[model samples]
Every structure is written in C-alpha cells, then in structure tokens.
Target: MNALVDVSFFPRAAKPLASYRKFWAARFGTAPFLPMSREEMNQLGWDSCDVVLVTGDAYVDHPSFGMAVIGRMLEAQGFRVGIIAQPDWQSAEPFKALGKPNLFWGVTAGNMDSMINRYTADRKIRTDDAYTPGDIGGKRPDRAALVYSQRCREAFKDVPIILGGIEGSLRRIAHYDYWSDKVRRSIVVDAKCDLLLYGNAERAIVEIAHRLSRREPIEHITDVRGTAFVRRSDDDTRLGWFEIDSTDVDAPGTVESHINPYQTTSEQAAGQGTTCSKEDQTVRPEPVEGQAEASTSSARTDAGSGSKPLRFMPNPALPQRVGKQVLPPRERTVIRLPSYEQVKS
Candidate 1:
C-alpha cells in the first residue's frame, strides 16, 4: 500500500488530502448524502456531478462504507460526487441516470470482490449478498468493476473512466484469477478504464480530481502514486524513475511451490501455520495479497550473479521510523513485475 510504503510510483503524500484548493462546486456545501438519482441531483440544485461513483453495494452514508467517506471527502474538496449503487447491470440506461459526470466515472465492486461475495471459497453459488439491501443474491455481476466500467463507458463515451476499490486494485496487475483459473490482464486493460487507482486512493484521487478539473488530460496524469494506466511500447513517457526488473529476483528453490490444491483441508491449514482452514469460511476477508506469493522477509536470496545468498533486514514497522536506515541512490526505484505477456506464457 502506497500509504504505507516510503516509495513507489511516488513517496507517501507530503501534502494533506484536504489541503488542496477546493473545487468550484465546494461552495454548494456537502449534500445530505451523495446524490443517487436524478431527483436527488435536482434536489441538490445540481445539473451534473463532478465525479460519479458506480458501486455494487446499496448506498449507505456511514463512514464504515468506504464510498461514503470518499464522496464526503470530494464534497469537502468542492466536488459534487454521485453514487450509482447496485444498478441493474443488464442495461446502460441506469448508468445514464446521473447523466454525464463533469470529470470522470469512478467504478468499484463494493466492499467485497464480486466473485468471492457471490460464491464460496469452494466455488459454490451463494444464496445471499450481504451488501444488498434485502440480502438478496445476484445484485452484482461476477466481475462488477469490469461490468460497471464498461457500462459507464457506454453511457458516456467521452468521459474518462477511473477504477478503484478492492476488486480493481488487486487486479491492477496480471494475477492468478482463482475463479477463472487463468492469469488475467490488468483490470485497467480488461475494463478499458483510463486509469486504475490501487491501495487507499485518498491521496491519488484528490490529486487526480484537481488536475482533471483544471482540464489536464487523464492520459497525462500517470505520475500519481498507486495509480496504473496503459502505454504502448513506443510511447515516450519520459518517466524519471529507475525500474529494477525483478523477474529474476528469486531462484526456483526446492521449497517454492503452491500449496497442494488437492490436499486434505487439515493439511492445508497446518502448512499455513494456522489451526483453522480458509476453506468454506463463513465471512470472506477484505482483499489482501494472494496466498501463492512466496514469503521473502526471512528467505535468503543470492542476487542473481552467482554470489552467496544473504538475508535482508525485514522492513521497518513504520516508514517514518527510519531509525538507522541505510542509503541507496535517491533515484525513485520500483520493481518491474513480470509483464502480462510473460505471465500468460
């Protein structure tokens, strides 16, 4: 999470989320709640929203509901934000209900990944949706971020589409799709979204919104930390970061392997150093790193030049507590993960 990391696409925010100049709409004050319908938008004396968030959960104006906090934050920043919650995905008319947004369409799959929310870890269909108002099932499509983004694009072809939330954030890169049993390309590519914001977009959203409001092109706003977008091989980004290719970061050690999918439930639990099995859990967890990634905190790695293996000091508890930290060149550096083509092959 960029909020936790000291470096990335950029360092942690030096500026506060609210410190930015408010948008022109901030003079209207915060809405009773983010407008969800044309009637509500009219009631708020608004013709168009600055940002419209499409979510798969019922509109709840509590801080516990993430979208609520985001809406209020934007409102505090003088942007009129609207919510399109759990709309009928069969058509694009519902998406057009809020009319076109003045800035961009923000899309999410709600509190949980759509596939996990609608199905059990064992891959069985679920009969109820916790996020749905009535606890009714099938309120969202299997891949809600993709569906909502596509529908938003259909509703307003010219408006930029930005995807966030756990679903889009986790899938921002090529990763194993346990549901599909294949490596899927980044969600930005699959959704054809102009940008994908990952891991706590508090800083990224505020910056991007302000820039877009000033008529800056979304395609040119690639420097925002924790956001991902596509670029052709020949595109001259002129980015000033050092990208370390990490494809060879680790050797194929004897112990490196995915846990046996066919193992007894008990065996799987023991291997994970947990007494409880993850299989068929009653409550699904918020998204986290995949279970398949190898742990490197204590693992010795011989940097790929035939040198002796060495253990890296585990990361500090807090990024700010850089107590006795060593130095590397001040060049902004990031790990260049395997390409989508490399992953698929």
Candidate 2:
C-alpha cells in the first residue's frame, strides 16, 4: 500500500473578511444593535431584513454569543440582519415577528448547547439560564436548534433555513445522546435545514451569504467547508474519486492496494483495470450494498504538488454489519456509514 501523503488541502493565504465587496445594501449603514422588532426595523428605515437570525439566547451584541457574531458579521457585509431572540417556539406566529428574511434564516441554539443549558449535570432540570435576561429559565425550549428550525420552516415555507452554533456543531454526526441513551441522527437530518455550518463558520457563512445574495440556488451550494447537507444516495457527478472501507481505518485489517487516481498517467496505466488518466475520469468500483455513488475529482493541495485524496467515513446510513455479504475493495476511496435506521438499532 502507498504511504499516506501529507497535503495542505486548504489555502494558506486567505482574503481578509474586511476585503470582501460590501453588499449593495451596505448603503443602509449599520444598526447599533440588529433590529429585533418591526418597529425597530421601521425606525431604521428598512422594509424587511436581508437575513433573520432565530436564536435561543437574548440578543447581546457580543462575540461570545453565536447569533450576535454571525448577525454582526453579515451586517458588516451590508445585509439587513434582524434578530428573533428566544421566540415562542410553540407557534409559528412569533417567528413572523421579523417578517421574512430575504436571504435566509440563520438559526442557532445560542452560546451553549440547549440540553446543557436547560438540564443539570445529574439530568435534573435547571431553574435558570444565564444566557437569558435576568437569569431566566424556560426562555428557550429543549433542542432549541431543531425546534427553532422547524418553526422557521413553518413560518416561511419557501425561505431557506441554515442551522449553526454549539448544538448544531456537536450533533453534526451520529453521537450517543446522553439524555436519550441512544445514537441520534445528524442535526442536519433532524432540522431539515438547507445547511448546517459546523466549527468556525465565519468564512463559510460569509461565502454562503454572498452566494445567496447573488441568487444562487441553495441546493447547489454544497462544496463549502464547515458545512454539511444530506444528498441523494446515487448523486455521483464528482469525477476521479474512489472509496476505502471504514473497517480499514477504524480497525487494523489487511486490505488490497488500489491505484491512486492522483498517480501519473504512466503509473495509472501500470495498475490493473485502472485508467483515470485525466482529471475528469474516475475509477468506479462495483456497487456495494447501501453504498452511494457519490464521487469528486481529486482535490489539489495548497502546495500544488499533487492531487489530494478525498476520504469520507461511511455515513451512518450505510454501515457494515455482521452476516452481510462482504463487498469487494475499491481504490482511492472511503466507506460510507449506514443509514440512520441501521445505526439507531
């Protein structure tokens, strides 16, 4: 087997956030605090917000708060940003307080995870939430990210919803739910949002917001880093890609060596049945049970020396199970996880 290659897949040089061309709406200037009510918007001489932030915490214009940081950052880009902090999630009416977001609704569970904020370490209900005004409790519901996202969808059926913050970041993948004692599906799957931004999302959020401003379809904006979205199992438009079984990565096991798509044309021609000479061509392995046909061209590293291999862990939707037929090995690829049903069991 070829030794793993160390490559810088991302650029070392990045344009500063301040250097982005301000949105045309930047002519409106900035608000002392993002408008929270229609009256405030009216006072600011605005008709509707470009982006509405639905958050579980009170609107404190501080970097410590996820909603504020994102809202202010978008505001700097000349987008009319509004806040719907701690809205009544029981109904969609409260979500309409900001009217409709022209761009999209940015939803977050506040600075901390909703479950951690609402529950005690011993699984007892907490009496107060520090994020709320006056240490108030019950301001936000449990699983605020998912609940708020659902309400946003109901309020504006056509508007796009983007989920973020601690709750979203933590639950981006299948993980054991301490409260329920079971592995829960990705929050992106549960929220049904257009996108879930995980980790430091400043760059991704800025790019997404700008792209949406340009009237780009949200569905087509999947390549951004720090974001996750669900796609059909058979969408394999990506070229020059391959797969690796998860078992090989997670547990040490003997595996067959396959030709790297990034190898030179002479090297590729030397390998059996592998002929991905051009960047557009891909080496497709035989379809295995529950595996999707997703593929992408070899990624270029920052050094620009060689193609960076793309490896994806088996999605929870496609797990390798006992008693299942063993699939043949594929070259230059990674395994996809089992479906939620299989993993939840």
**In order, what lDDT does every prediction score?**
0.80, 0.79
Give one digit per residue, the lDDT tens place, for model 2 in 1-345. Answer: 111111112333545788889898899888888999999999999999999999999988888787888888898988999999999988999999989899999999899999999998899999999999999898999999999999999999899999889899889766789988899888887888888888888988898899999999887775565677766545552233344434454642335787687878766665656555574366567666444333222223343665567875654655454553453433323345455665688
Tens-digit lDDT track for model 1 on 81-134?
999999998989999989999999988999899999999999999999888888
Candidate 1: residue 44 Cα off by (Å): 1.1
Model 2 alpha-carbon miss at residue 215, Å = 0.8
Angstrom error of the Cα, residue 42, model 1: value is: 1.2
CA lDDT for candidate 1? 0.80
Off by over 4 Å in 1: 1-9, 238-242, 248-334
Please list the residue runs of candidate 2 whose C-alpha ends up more than 4 Å from where it truly belongs after superposition: 1-15, 234-245, 249-335
Q: After superposition, how far is residue 119 of candidate 1 from its true place, in Å?
A: 0.8
Clashing pairs in 1: 26-78
**Position 285, candidate 1: lDDT:** 75
